[model samples]
Structures are given as C-alpha cells and as structure tokens.
Target chain A: MTELALAIENLSFAYGAKKALDDVSFDVRPGECTILLGPNGAGKSTLFSLITHLYDSRQGRIALCGFDIKKQSLKALARLGVVFQQTTLDPDLSVTQNLRYHAALHGIGRKAADNRIQEELERLNMFERRGEKVRQLNGGHRRRVEIARALLHRPSLLLLDEPTVGLDVPSRQAIVEHVHALVKEQNLAVLWATHLIDEIAADDSLVVLHRGQIKAKGKLDYVLQTTGANDAGEVFNKLTEGHKG
Target chain B: MRLLHYWRAMMGIVGRELLRFLHQRERFISALVRPLVWLFVFAAGFRAALGVAISPPYETYILYEVYITPGLIGMILLFNGMQSSLSMVYDREMGSMRMLMVCPLPRWFLLGSKLIAGTAVGVLQSYAFLGIAWAYDIQAPLMGYVWILPALVLVGMMLGALGLLLSSLIRQLENFAGVMNFVIFPLFFMSTALYPLWKIKESSEILHTLAHYNPFSQAVELIRFALYEQFNLDALIFTALSFFVFMSAAIFGYNPSKGMMVRKGGGAP
Candidate 1:
C-alpha cells in the first residue's frame, strides 16, 4: 500500500450555522497527484482552508504525513508547502528578496536559503529576473516565482489551490505538466485543486465535491466509467444533477 | 541559522514598508510637514500666551519649540502606527494579507517583521524631524540624541503593536479614519507634549486627571523623560503596561481560527 500523505476523516465545517463542508473525508497518497474536482460553491475553498489551518474544522481531523494538523501544526506545517489561491508577496521587493523572506519563514537559514533559491530559480528558468522587483514581472513569471517560493523548503506534501485558474492554455499546461513531473520525481504528494476538467490526469485519483459533500471519489477511470461518462466534467454534472450511486 | 532567518525576514519587511513610503513621496512630505507646521506656525502663536521654563529634563533656559521635541516624537510614532494599521486593512481588501498567511513562517514572526518595518520608518522620520529641529536651532544637547534613538524605537514598537491590534479589529478601512480622528487628536492635545501636566492641572483639575489616566500621556511622558536623559519610572510603567495591553489585544485579534479569519468566513466584498 502507498504511504498515506493526507487523511481527512469526518471533517465538518460551518460559517454561522451555514454548512460549508459537511461530513467530508478523503485521503491523498504519497507520490501521487490527487485533483480536488468541484463546481462553484462545492466547498472546495472551504476544505482547502481547513487543510491549510486557515479555519479549524468543526469536527474530525486532518493528518499531513501522519502528523495531526491541530495538535502538531508547526511541525506538520513545516513538512508541508502551499501556493495560496491569491498571490501573497510584497510587490516592492525584488524576486530574490521575496523568496529569501519566504525561506526564512520556513526556518531555512541564509546559506541554505540562498542555495535553495539558486537551485529553484534555475529550475524555474527565472534566474535572469532574480534582481527585478515583483511588480515588474509579468503575470506568468510572477506565478512561477510563487511556485518556486513554495518549493524552497522541499516539502513532502504540496497544496496548490486553483493553481491554473487565470492562466492561458500554455501557461496552465506548463504548470500542470511541471507538477506532474515534480510529484513522480520527488516522491511528493500533491493536492491539486481545480474546477477545470481537462487539467485532471487520467492516472491521478479524483475527488468530486458537490454543494459541500463528496459526491464521487476514487481512481479517475473507475469514477468516470461508473458514471458512464467519457470525462470527469460529465461525471461531475451527472453527480450534481441528482444522480446518486 | 535562526537568527539569520529573522534578520533576513526583518530586512525584507522593512525594505518593503520603506519602499511603499518612498513611492508615495507626497504622503511622507505631507506627514512631515504637518508636525513642522504645528511647531513653527501653530506653536509660534501659542508660545507668547505661555511661559516657557527649564523643565526637569532640560539643563538651562530653552525655547518652547525645544521643549516639545519629545511630544513631537510621540506624534511621529502615533501617526505611523495608525497608518500601518490602516494599511493592514487595505491589504486585506486588496487580498495581499491573504497571500502572506500561506507562507510556512510563524504568524507572529510575520506580524513582528511588519511591526519592525513600520517602526523603522517611524524612527527614520523621527531622525529627519530631529535634523529639521537642529537646522532651525531648536537644538537639545547633542548627547540628548543617544537616548532619543532607544526612545523612538520603544515608542515605535508600542505604537506598532497598537496599530497591529487595531488593524485586526477594525475590519474596514472606512471605519478607521473616524476612529483615528477621535483617537489621535485627543491623545496629542491631552498629553504632556504641548504643556506639562501641572500646567494642564493649573488650568483645570479635571483636564489634568483625564490626561494623567490617558495611556498616551504616559507614552509622551516616556519619550519626554528620555529626551531629557532622565528616565521616569511612572512613564516606564505606563509604557510597559500599554505595550502589554495593546500586544495582548493584537494577539487576541490575530488568533487564526478565532479572530479575523473566522470573522472573514463569508469572504467580504
């Protein structure tokens, strides 16, 4: 059996008595990319928020690499990396400064931070622009910098919340292919969140969230075949349109 | 390694905050000019109506302008702190604050770095104002500055913490200006900056009592005491207490699941 990278069991959350995530549960395995597939208002953001410890779940627990999120947050968080749904960087600082600051936050020292920054910048093909301020970079390069910053600490589990939402086809595809290769090469567990169907890899596991509940989940081919659909989007629509197992 | 990390984080944060002020030159010029106007123009008229004397911190005869240096320093801190808090709200509105939350760093470290950066700007402005004071011959003893640096730092930190605490509570930037209006002016007018507490007492015992209880009075007094090279124990206690209170409130306001995060569950427009 694969090592469990993330385990969320009986998780429930609310906003002022309104349910955002209800009785949600799923596991993402090590060395694999698991896509969280959902439509709008399907509790994807809310679930992402809980996994990130942005909001504590009202019930159940989230374990990252077997570390409970609530009880051992820093240690658990230390082993995890994330690119938020929105960009969170100082526009005034140079690309190098932003990455360096992020490195320090993860307890990475100057020598290691510099070393890792160099390695990642080269990997992202962004070394030439290191000295440029963030506001000066175009959207695609800026997003690349964010991705590079997230990988600075070599986290075992990487969370990308709607990573390709606003990107053009080539840019989105680049991120999609890059993450796929990174997961296999590094033995990293990735929770890739997106509403777009085409981003889902046939080999990747899939979880379908609908209106705050997991309507379908498991192997991408199996789930798609069970719904008698050619693609995940059709399966998603069928699940939302009152079709039940 | 850890120290190096903090140093880098602090440097990054301070660099960003400073750059923000640099890009907005008009605002800084206006901020600096306001206090100078209060000194040269407003105080000029008020100086004749009052008797200036050698205070506890002053060694000999001094002009009214020289006497109010500490109070003016307090103004720098107070305004900077409020501006920092106001920007915190603005960052949330612009989605920048949300971005910072995802970094693997300790939340307090992030907050602390921002405070240090804001404090740094306050100190820089204080020094510039000090330079202007010297240029105009409103000079304190040259040695008076050694104490001034630490005083500016302490006062900046206290006010930065206050701003951070206020930022988390004041969810909307629209709500800030009105509250700050009520807060800043009263604190400045009631403090020992313009006149000694005793003078306010001579004018009205009730005003003296009000000023005595004002935490801002304590902050201004702390700076005043430091500027004169005499540490006031009461000022120290008051400053320490205010720091604790504001810091505690800030801690409460920023508690991830309980405070601002939960309050923002609906995701305001």
Candidate 2:
C-alpha cells in the first residue's frame, strides 16, 4: 500500500470568534492528486496555512510523511513543497538564482542543487531560460519556474494553491497535465487547491469544502454517488449554494 | 548536516540581498547622496556656528566636515537599515516573506540571517561612503578605517534590529511612512549623530538625557569613537543591550501566533 504523504486530523481554525475551518480532516496518499474545491473564503487558504505552519492551528494536527507538523515542524516542512496562490518570485532575480536560493534554504549542497536545478528546469523545458530574469518570463513561464523551484528539493508532497489562477486555457491545461504526469511518473502526492471546476479530472480525488466544513470527500465517482449529483457542478452547488452567508 | 543547511540558508539570503542592492542603482546613488548632502551642505552651514575644542582624538581644531564624517557614516547605515526593513514590508506584501518563513529552519535563525544580511549591506554602504569621504579629504587615521569595521557591523545590527522590530509592528505598506516620520526621525535627531551629547546638554538637560539614553545615540557614539580608534565602553554596553532588546522584540513580533502577519493568513494581497 502507498503511504500517506499528508494527513490532517481534526484540524479546525478560527479568526477571533468567527470559524474558518471547522473540524476538517483528510489525507492524501503518495502517487495521487487530491483536489481541494471550495469557493472564495471557504477556508481553503486557512487549511493551507495550517498545513504549511504559516498560521498556527489551535485545534488539530498535521503530519507530513508521518512527521507531526507541530512537534516536528522542521522535518515536516523539509518534506513538503508549496506554490502559494500569489507569485513569490523576485522579479529582479534570474530563474536560476531563485531556484538556487530555494535549494540553499532546503540545505541541498551546491553541486547537488545545481544538478537538481538543471534536472527540474530541463524537465519543465525551462533550462534555456534559466538565466533570464523572472520579469522577462510570461505568466505561464513564471508558473513553470515556480513549479520547477518547488520540485528542486525533491519534495514528496507538493501543494499548489490555485497554481493556474490567471493562466490562459492552454496554459492551465498544460500545468494540470504536467502535475498529473508528475503524480503518475514519480508518485508525488499533490494537494491542489482551486475554485476552478474544469481543472478537475475524473480520476482525481475530490474534497468539497464549504462554510468551513467538509461536505464531501473521496474519489470523484464516489463523491458524485454519495451527493446524488450528475456532475461536480451540481455537487458543488449542492454543498455550497445556500450556505453562502 | 543541519549546520551546513543553516549556513547555506544564510548565504542564500545575504546573496539575494546583495544582488537586489546591486540591481537597484538608484538606491545606491540615493544612499550615498543623502550623506554627501549632509557633509557638504549641512556641515558647511554649521561650520562657523560651532566651535571645536581640543580632544583626545582631535589635538587641534577640526573642520565641521571632519567632525561629522563618522556621523555621516552612521547615517548611511541608519538609512540602509530602515531601507532593508522597507523591503521586508514589500516582501511580505509580495509573498516572498512567506517563502522565507517556510524554509524548515527555526524562525529565529531565519530572522537572524536576515539581520545579518541587512547588516552586511549597511557595512558595505559604509565602506563606500567612507571611500568617497576619504577622497574628498575628510581624513581619519589609516588604521582607523580597518578598526571601524566591527563597529560598523554592531551599529548596523542595532539599527537593523530596530527596523525589523518596526516592520513586524506595522501591518501595512502605507503605515511605513509613519515609521520613517516617527521612529527614524526621532532616533536620528535625538541622538549624537550631528552633535555631541555635551552640546545638547548645554541647550537642555532633558534633551541631553534623551540623547544619552537613545540607543541611536549609543550606536553613533560607538561608531564615532571607533572611527578615532578609541572604544567607548558605555556606548558598547548600551548598544549591545539595545540590540538584544530590539532583536528579542523583533523575534516575538514575528512569531506567527501573536504577529501581525498571520491575521491575514497566506492569501495576503
């Protein structure tokens, strides 16, 4: 059996008295992509923050490859890579510099970092543009650079928070395909958060979150069967429509 | 192995900071220009207004340019510290701070590395400023230049800590102007940057005491004495204490739970 790369148990978070993520729990096994589908302000960002330990979660536990985030944050974070919703690249720095800086932060040796950087950039077909400043790259290419940077440390689990937010249809489709290919080719566990519906493939696992609660979670077919819906659109509406407050 | 990672992390941060500094040509020019204006214009205006007495370092009367040269170096470092913190605020807004914070190292180490980077930049600016001043004939003992390096680092770290603490306290980019007006100005004016404490004492006892206690005053004094190849023990102790206090406050202010950063979460715009 494939081991779970990420595990969230009884995770709940709040902003003052307002509940953001309530009693949410889930797991993503290696070699699979779990889509976290939610509307804006549906606590998806909060969940990512808790997993990344950017925001402390008072109520539950997060584990990466069986390492508890709270007690073993260093080990947990060491094994995890993230691409936040916003682009984090420095526009003035070259692509190679950005990747090298990230690799150094992860403690990869310089020679090892160079090899990994070359490998990831080559795999993404961005090796030729490695010397170009990030500002010179188009949006899709920047996203590709971010993905390559995320994989430079060879993380077991990669969390992409709406990685295709502003891309064109082809760019979005290409990124989604690339991630799915990574999962299949390398057994990389991915927890991709997105509000876009068209990006979800039939074989991907689905977790529907609304009003700070998990309404449904499982394989797409299983979620559809349990929600009594024809497709993901109806299932999403069934889980979220009236709850908008 | 972990130690190696920490070392690399620091090098990465410092390298990025230097690269950014190099890319921004206007910043380097402005950093140098600010102090030069003070040296040539402000000092020239105050030349006849103040009288210099024989002191340990100055065996005879000195020019206002010579008197304020060390203070000018302090100013370069001071502005650079605040400027680095301004970048920190920008980095936070741009999502790069989150990138730095999630590096799997302890938070304090991350912060400490950033402070080291900022200090290194400040020291580099100081050397550049000093070179220009030396060429302009605002002379110091030949050995004074070498001896002042450590003093520059300490003063840079202190001011950088103050700036870091301020960045953690201020939430928005718009609020940073308030920091410049409130924190930076007061620290610069109330200190011995432009005038000695005795000069302030002659004007008002309260102002003298404020200048004496101001950490910036201690920082300036630390650098001022070192520029003459002398050491001020009181200034050393005071600046060191302030560094600890400010850095501790910064570390606490940057704590994710109680910090200004976490309230917005990672989806910060």
The per-prediction i-RMS, to one decimal, reads 3.4, 2.2
lDDT of 2 by residue, B64-154 (tens): 7887887888888889889988988888888899889887998889989999999998898899989998898987888888889999999
User: Given the true complex, what DockQ would model 1 score?
Assistant: 0.38
Fnat of each prediction, in sequence: 0.40, 0.72
Per-residue accuracy of model 2 over A86-129 as CA lDDT, tens digit each: 89999999999999999999998889999999999998899999
lDDT of 1 at A117: 95
**Candidate 2, DockQ score (0 to 1):** 0.66
lDDT of 1 by residue, A1-245 (tens): 66588999999888887888889899988788999888778888888777877666769899988888888776677777887667766787789988877776666777888999999989888998999999998777777898898899898888888877777888888888888988889988999888888998889999988888998888999998878888887987788884342
lDDT of each: 0.80, 0.88
Clashing pairs in 2: none
Pick the lDDT winner: 2
